[model samples]
Target: MALPTVPHLSQDGIAFSAVKNRPAYAIASVDSALLLASLLQQEGAMRVTDVAARLGVSVSTAHRLLGMLVYRDFAEQLPDRRYAAGPVLRRGPVQQASVARLREVALPHLRGLVEAVGETANVMVLAGPDVRFVATVESDQVLRVGDRTGRTLPAHLSSGGKAVLATLDDERLAAVVASLDAAVAVRLERELRTVRRRGVAVNDQETEAGLTAVGVAVPPSGGVTGAALSVAAPSARYSRDRLPVWKEALAEAAGGIARDLGDG
Candidate 1:
């Protein structure tokens, strides 16, 4: 059976031509990820051959794709080497067990970051093309930014989103760029390259004027989705030259959170 092609704009707000006829432009990795996700969500645990047969791909391809899913925490390797829906997916969409766990584990570190940098600290997770702010700790300073917990913003516009984006592999990145406008794709690709080189992502008032944020991706754990720890401060107080502590704090906090998730 042929999959239906649905019209949608890419992250860069560029329209994709219908995939039904022009299959050449279709991103195989993205399609495979979607197919595998659907299978795992509906069937729970599965073996390598199961995914291979369902996606009609080679066993090696299935294994490679599944590994990526595991890296992003959308799937996990079971004791027998079979794959199962990961904690993030099993917890369901929206605020639930996994998200709650992430929030609980991250809040203390976020607070510590606030104390360290005198800026607002946040934990953000990728939700499709956006980064959702699941938890935040506000700075004590009167001039600090407002609490942004529960807010959602475009992934490319925020530090956390860019950090997560930087972790995507080439095929996945190609899929994303394919959906964006020519101009936006070029710009976002350039930025992601920079993020990869630096091991961190920065938002210099990109999401909102006068606000600056620096973020680092949290390494994947058993049940954690790709996420980032970020510190947002007023640009006046966010001087990169003087705020090296913020980078150090985010790295420490991200490491702690990843460790906790691994232990669970």
Candidate 2:
């Protein structure tokens, strides 16, 4: 049977006809496996049944293929029994190096920020349209925000993400907005303009109902593009009057990280 094909389009929206035809000697099983991997990587979590339906294969065959992908470290079964792209499939050495270096150099600054603001502080990097928390330092206060390491949130909704978004050039910013809903894209663009003017971004119960955060972009340096520093606190503890203090502390921490990256 011929493999199912989707039309490939260039940046200018021109279709590429050459890629539509399956090769003469294409192996069905190999093609199915590769296609399944692509689905997992692009669509995020999927159940076994969803995989079977998407691949036009039997449930047993889908299970076996997913098993092989798991064995090869290309996919992992989530706690909810859904499959997602695994470590191997998510690896990007250059991006990883930047994330790692940024996390390392920002730790001390994060700690300092936490001390100054008495709130949780985090370092995050933009991964596509999402922001991934790389490191976090929690405040000692009992009612403070918790560490957010390894958490991923929509870049447009996150304080750190919006701060980073404000730093992006027009073309890059447009690409990111294009991936979002029209209304959301318009709202985000307006917010980014404010972030740019103030040099700080605020997340007022956006990501979480009772949490508030303020962030500043860590200026790009040493091959790192979109990285930010944020301090989070409980909404009860947040107020407009505190913005100046929080913004100052976050800017100081972000600047320290940028300076450290420059020296390294």
Candidate 3:
């Protein structure tokens, strides 16, 4: 069976596209480093031998490249000798023009959401098992959730991340959940079920001690889903009583973003 392809927001925003042709003056080592990073991000984990074979380089060369990645926090060596995506890869932007376009298109909607809900709003995209905040619009209130752009949080813990996961097909969802610890996987599965049932996800301090957020998936365009829209506030100001209003605002913003993306 084919390995499940993790979606990233790119020009197409969903399906994996082949890397562009190698440049005429391309430095081999840099190219290899980039490809290796992409491999770890998409394929979960691999041994040095696997990396060598995949990159068609000698084992020593692969090892050297892996060392560089580890230094840069893009990959980490496992106790078993396999390497997996590390901090940078998990939080990195999509590195495509479409991500910029997506951010631009979503900003107005995000601003509108902040106006409606009177809290910070964010646009997030799934990156491997993590969610990267690509854009944020902060509330004008004296005390509010601050901007989180360029930050990453565990997908199983963040409201926007859970919302994105809820949009995944079963196979894709299983692939993601399998990467987590057994205990986390069990709990995440339960939360995801609730997300599916309610058409929204909530993070009541699951990611941070003082933050609470509500999110909805930006409906997939062309059968691809990787992004979500959320409204976040300080936990002190969060209440179940506010959920109905927040959910409605999030849904509207999500829909508007989806329509804009589809039309693009």
Winning candidate number (TM-score): 2
Local distance difference test values of all predictions, in order: 0.75, 0.79, 0.77
Best lDDT among the predictions, by candidate number: 2
- Which 10 residues in a row give candidate 3 its minimum summed lDDT? 13-22
lDDT of 2: 0.79
> Per-residue CA lDDT of candidate 3, range 137-160, in tens?
878775566556555688888898
* Better structure of 1 and 2 per TM-score: 2
Total clashes in model 2, counting residue pairs 3 or more apart in sequence or in different chains: 0
Model 3 residue 248 CA deviation (Å) reads 0.6
Task: Show the colliding residue pairs in model 2.
Answer: none
* Each model's total of backbone clashes: 0, 0, 0
Candidate 2, superposed: residue stretches over 4 Å from native: 1-87, 91-94
Candidate 2 Cα deviation (angstroms), residue 87: 6.2
- Candidate 2, residues 176-204, lDDT tens digits: the string is 89999999999999999999999899998
Q: For candidate 1, write residues 1-264 as lDDT tens digits.
A: 121331333433322121123244679798788667645653467899988986789999999999999999889999999998786677544434566578778888888888887778889887767777777787766555555555667788789989998998888667656767899888998999998987889988776656778999999875777688988876777676844677788889999999988887
Q: What's the alpha carbon RMSD for model 3?
A: 14.9
TM for candidate 3 is: 0.65
